[model samples]
Target: MSFLKKLKEKISKQTDTVTEKFKHGLEKTRNSFADKVNDLVYRYRKVDEDFFEELEEILIGADVGVSTVMELIDQLKEEVQRRNIQDPKEVQAVISEKLVGIYKGDSEFSNEINMQEDQLTVVLFVGVNGVGKTTTIGKLAHKFKSEGKSVLLAAGDTFRAGAIEQLEVWGDRVGVEVIKQGSGSDPAAVMYDAVQAAKARKVDVLLCDTAGRLQNKVNLMKELEKVKRVIEREVPGAPHEVLLVIDATTGQNGLSQAKTFREATNVTGIVLTKLDGTAKGGIVLAIRNEMDVPVKFVGLGEQMDDLQQFDPEQYVYGLFANLVETEEV
Candidate 1:
């Protein structure tokens, strides 16, 4: 069976609500990227050098990253040559398959949160200001609460004005408690207190928010290190996951932010926010390929339940949903 058909079948087995979320969230990217690809295939009936070149441009324009686009183009050429594919329409499935391949690479990386069973799971969120870091934390808290897990929020972002209040708002909205301190207090101290509270309360999960100051790399690194040290000292093998939240609409700039945050701390995964706001959703592939970090969650929309776990198959299905539904097995 064809790859698109296989993906269609797989998605069909999943919850209809989740599949529809992916499809609707990716509407912008689909209307831009997939439409162009379809038009390109129609304009060129046969796969050839010129066809590949135009496809390359389309991928690049979709913010797939130049290096990744080049690699994908090369892979497509080889696949076409090996399969002796002449019809340009046949390459669409190949493109989707290669996209999933590039995102997954060679390993089967799990995108689920690394929760500690029978113990408190500490998830530290780090990213620049205005990247929707706090919002993602709120949504994630809601998700855990919906799953019947006890969750606590730690407001460690003391530097940013109203940061604590913002987190408190989310905490109230989600019905989760927020542990915070007065503004201008040391962030490490806040983490220390938060850890103690979590331990006393026996919370299942604690999501900590940090200040997003990137003007000085050294200060940011030091602050994060100190916060991490406090968490480690309080709970052995804690801070289970350091998630860097990046705004998907920022495109390549988001990749640069990931590099900075990755250097500041051990970023186990990423939370790409505002994905539905951008037409070039290919930034997902660029981030996975370039950063070598799995995107654990994606902010599909503004709704509280829109923060969904990252699934490559569902993502590809979202990108090509129109074609997938219309294609024959």
Candidate 2:
């Protein structure tokens, strides 16, 4: 069985708290592409320029991004020539092969979060407002705690109202300590407090949630830089991984946000949230194809376990799972 199907079976009995939390994500994606891709398979039976053209339209429409769609189309075209064949049945296999190839290799697909740093593994999550940054941090805390890693959360998003309380609630749910100051307070102070507490608490991982800014790019950059500087002063070259959480439903917009955040804080890896609900799961491919960053995790739902390590094979297969339409030909 596919890992995702197995994953579903494993997580299903666990209840739908996480599923319900992220149901919108999957619903958005399924409604966006699952049915549409099914419709494509229903309509096409041959490999032709017309088929490729329409297929390109479908993929691009689903927010796989332009570069990735072109790469996929080219790979599909080559596969058609390689076998000296034109059957649409072969196209499915070829598409699967091409999609899996996007992972670069098995090494690239490795999900191990190596914390070979000198001290604490600090993960600084950044993205625009509403990318589930705080929620992702909560889930990460829960994941780390499950692994026997004492985790701490920092409400670095002190600018947003209820940001501290939001993280505190997650801390309570996950059974971790969250350090924070009041709203409108400096995020750097909150992070410093969290780091100091984490050091004393001997936490394995420190997940810091930063403020989400809108239109104030200059202020955002300054604030993130300040947070980084403070952590380095206290923790010695800290902020191990600057993880950027992105909503896959945002499509190309997410990729652009990654670029901006990368410029602002040197993003080390990405955490893509809300993939289960968006048809634009293709954005994962787009980001991989276009950006210098690696996707470390994907939030399929809001459950702690839903924040799964990024697996390209599972994602690609899931995307094309409904390839064989059960409609009358």
Candidate 3:
């Protein structure tokens, strides 16, 4: 079957438990985004230039990024013409389909984290402070540990006050060990020690938390280089993944952070946190199209089990569940 066919099947076969989770998690975005699109269908009886214009406004207003929105509108127009779609209500499913297609693009989109089957998988988290970087680490630790994988956390964010303690609190809550040293210690040194500890314990995954300070790009680049060098030296080709955590509530500002950090380091994937707290959940498409980074996970709610693996189909479905073709339609 084709990728789109498989995706639709997966979404159809998705258990109610998971579907409801996404539905509730994306309630705010649904109300803001899907509701508007549904209203557009109600206003416009036929698909025409005016319909496309209003649709563009809705997407741009949802913070989907101008470039991505333009591309989507063009592709959507072509699809509408190709399929000879007319009714405005029938265009809703086409919009969701195109959004997913844009995110997936020509290549496959893998939302899974890169794992080392034989040895340890070192994952580094980077983003500005107050973006829920630390909390994401904690939730991930919980996730891996629940999978029966041994997880170790390294407190490399030495610059931020109480950073170590905060990670420690998470470690304690999640029942994982955190390696750390005194505040003001070299962040690279902390990484070195964590590498040694992971190797000694043969941990399945080692997650490192770095300073959220992004003000000084030069210093940030140098510091990150040092940490990466230490990890690579300790374990050849280590740091299998460098995941950039972004707060969905920040909207486009989060996209700017992704651009800056991508230039600073090799950001393999994105972990979008606090999605439920934002109405501009369309930022996901902007990030994928703009930064070209696959979102690995998303924070749906504030609970421990709320950090869900990013599924593009479910995401689009959740956003448009209320607007999609229904029995009533």
Candidate 4:
């Protein structure tokens, strides 16, 4: 088969079964977003000013950022004019292509964790307390362990009561060792110890959970800096990935949280949690468009395997499965 055909087949297979996580996780978004688009196309058979206006509304309402919506609309206009298309229904495919393009802007798309080949890879988790930060760390540990890599968890979230215990619980569940200190201890100290232990044991990955206190950005920044310094001091060029976890159900508020967290530290990627719980999955587009950070992982369900790497093709197919089928027909 030709490369394009093969690629489409792969994406189709993924949407059919391989990407059931995204398909099921994005069910709410598919229903709401697809319904709105289908309705709009049905209402306006001809592409006109009103169609563009309604399309903008739908995109914005789907939690696509205003800036992203504007850019998309502009691109849509250009595509429509360039293609000389008149049917709004025919524009659906173009819209999907554009949406995916927005996320891929100028750079290669990737969801892979940047792990060191021959050394310990440290991932520092950061976000506000209630955004599933600890849970993400645990889930990631499980994933890394399942991959046959020696994984360790560092309970560096010393500020929250029971934070250390929670990470330890996850460590126990995943059959990995957890390095921790008492609650309210210096988070940097925990990181220091974790790095030393990881190096000593020849661990493959070290997942660190840090305090989620974001009320005071200055304090949080300082604390994170100290932790980062300690990790680098122990192992130069450590903390391979600083992942920012966000609750997908938070809608646009999640975007706001991302902006704040990015300002506080260098966030390499995003982990969107609770994706199955919200109808505002369009926030994914807004996130990549506005924040320019790749979404590393998405939480689809409560199962250990629900946290899958983000795939743009699968995501687009999942979101617009019905629309794509209709277009093919």
Candidate number achieving the greatest TM-score relative to the actual structure = 1
Please identify model 3 stretches exceeding 4 Å from their true place: 1-9
lDDT of 3 by residue, 15-115 (tens): 87777778889999999999999889889879999999989999998999999999999998998899898888778777888888899987678999899
Model 4 stretches with alpha carbons more than 4 Å out: 1-8, 13-16, 327-329
**Candidate 3's error at 305, in angstroms?**
0.7
Q: Estimate each model's TM-score.
A: 0.98, 0.85, 0.96, 0.95
Scored by lDDT, the top model is 1
lDDT of 2 by residue, 1-329 (tens): 43334444554664455444344445565566656655665577777898889888988887778888887899888868988865665565566567768655334444556574445888888988898998899888888888778788888887777888988998899898878787888889888898899888777899999987858888999999999999988887678788889988787889888888878888878899888767667787777777846788888865568887776655654554444222112
Q: What value does the lDDT take at residue 220 in candidate 1?
A: 98
lDDT of 4: 0.87
Query: Given candidate 1, what's the lDDT at residue 69?
Result: 97
Can you tell me which runs of candidate 2 are displaced by over 4 Å? 1-42, 105-110, 323-329
Answer with 1 or 3, whichever has the higher lDDT.
1
Pick the winner on TM-score between candidates 2 and 3.
3
Ranking by TM-score: 1, 3, 4, 2
Candidate 1 minimal-lDDT segment of 10 residues: 320-329
lDDT of 1: 0.94
| Whole-model alpha-carbon lDDT for candidate 3 | 0.91
